[model samples]
Target: MALHLPQAASLPFGSLTKMLPLNKTSSSVSAISKSFNATTSLKIQCKAPSVIVSDQSQQVSRRSGDFKPDVWHYDYIKSLDNNYKEHAYEEESRMLRAEVRVFLSDTVNPLQQLELIDTLQRLGLAYHFKSEINKMLENIYSVDKFKNKQNLHATALEFRLSRQHGYDIPTDVFDSFINDEGDFQTSLSQDIKGMLSLYEASFLLMEDETILEKATDFTSKSLRDFMSRNPGHELTSQVKHAMEVPLHWRLPRWEARWFISEYERMPNMNSNLLQLAKLDYNMLQAMYQEEVKSNIRWWERTGLEEKINFYRCRVVDNYLWGLGMKEEPHVEKLRRVIGNLCAIITLTDDMYDVHGTLDELELFTEAILSGKISVRHLGLRPDGTMVEKRQA
Candidate 1:
């Protein structure tokens, strides 16, 4: 669902200014003036040695963010309703999850098991089988056959998965693949899958690991050369995507969205797993839509948008930022808290960065430091009433 928001404006500083004795000559005011003068190098020449002239009457030009209006609209967000939220869909998802779990249990080959774990993670279904995955990885790590493996893809995958799950697999795991001159073997370039895996695994390198560093440079150049040589190869797309951004650094939800489509094109893609991923994604998307709507409503009730107009009005963007941090369905409360905090922070940041006058910002900072204003004070209405806090 697409929801568009208007460009945000500055917050109301009147209440903050009123919280302090603006007319009285206090130490705080002198300190603020000194700090501002030091930063701006303003020369104030006054006949009275202790008096400072105020510039409140002067017209001050404010900077603007020049940010465009939000793309997602409130009406569009409210209109979003997917059938995946139905009970029948949830029941079907449970059945598919069970089938996939059984498949995971039945898989015996080490390489296949690693591939399956990688697939589940990429598809964003790993959380549903956390214990099972941990058990599998534990068993794989305990076997300790990575040094004996001749297949570069298997070794690289094993190294990557092990390090990712907190197993301290060492850099020496790649010693067999490196030549005496301390470089990756040139013959390994012919194995595209292995090269891609090495490229991915190289990202897990720690400080001072020169071998993985060399592997990164080697696999990067090799993957580019291979892609140029075989432009129409099935693995070319995956290679190019990997070269752009390694899987280790990608966001879970976004990667799942892209990989699900790519997985559909794979020859050996599991039907049950594919269906489960699709259903799970849609269900989560629907829930996120509701969460965004709730946050937008909260924003409206605060009356901050109508009262102040110089900050970014990005309720949807803020919620999505929270989603990127905690994508699990069960963490709805944490997600909402994060979203609200992000919204408030963005508004306050814009005020300091783009809109607030020097004196006004100082007063706000002082109020915060003196404990005269709390986060709850941010929900104050134009009529001097408090907006009731919403329960998560």
Candidate 2:
């Protein structure tokens, strides 16, 4: 990221002896010539005697090729560099500010906030966003008047983003995102995002595998219980498939979570899901390895697992999109390999879930149940929007 600059020009000079000659006898003339030769020798130092003085254009070319401009010396250069860096920072800050403005402009959810934070991180501006989110949290939490508001839950995005980054989010911050006056059902998708972030943060922020395992085990059980009890739902089949299918054909939650308690219980006993998830993770790791293979020496030198994990997130997210959760498109030319890596991981996750299902859950019982598993909701029509169906 360093800026390149050209070199300065050398001062002009003339042959000292040419303009000052002495009239002399042979001895004096010889002495004069010897002195002149000595002076010329000293001026040249170790350089070859025939070295050419550069022309204006040649000097320019030499400066351009062989030297950088002294950016530190020029007031304008220093000013410009500082201003540009600050401008870039401000541009990112503005984007985050606009995102917050949108959050405040209408009803939003923790999910949207999570999604936004994720976006900021991907865009390399999360640091600037951290302060903006903090200010919003403070503004909302400093008064009881706003505490009872429904829009508070929408702002939970700030709380979750801050919490996930281990950025000191107070309980009051969480309080600001919840409605004191209502039953707390605001944005379903955002709620899901908040729940997922909470689940992830418990593991992510802690960095203790034991804690993560306990959290994972608990979430697994709770999710399973929810799935098991909610049988005969359309989403069950979709959920079952998502748990088992590869990314390209995987189901969205509306289609996947139709069956209730199976998600919680069945996958635990089923080795297929565990293996599939592992396989998907491994495949993603492999693709990441290939990505860094050319720089394997560099990666080993730096111990860049954070970058590796970040890329894995990308793979998982892409798989989610391949399953119909369209994420924002990333257009870096070198990173196109990420899409392929995700495709493989998505398929593997589905296969794992499929192999891990309980015998009873695995058996498609729609015909035998005689509409017991069929959804009778208004949005059950095939042409209905997935978002509407999910809300239903």
Count of steric clashes across candidates, in order: 12, 36
Q: Please, what are the lDDT tens digits per residue for candidate 1 over residues 1-392?
A: 11111111221111001111111232122211111112133222111112323435676766666655554455545555544456765777788889998999999888899999999999889999999889889998898766766789999999999999999999888888988898989999999999999999999999999998999999999999998899999998889888877888776777776677778779999977887886787677667767877777777777776676667777767776677777889988677777787888888898898778899999999998998877667664433223677699
Q: Model 2 compared with the native: what TM-score?
A: 0.24
Candidate 2 regions off by >4 Å?
1-104, 108-160, 163-198, 203-205, 232-333, 336-392
Off-target runs (Cα >4 Å) in candidate 1 are: 1-58, 379-392
Q: Which candidate comes out best when scored by lDDT? A: 1
TM-score of each: 0.81, 0.24
Highest TM-score model number: 1
Q: Relative to the true structure, how large is the alpha-carbon lDDT of every model?
A: 0.73, 0.32
Residue-level lDDT for 369 in candidate 1: 91
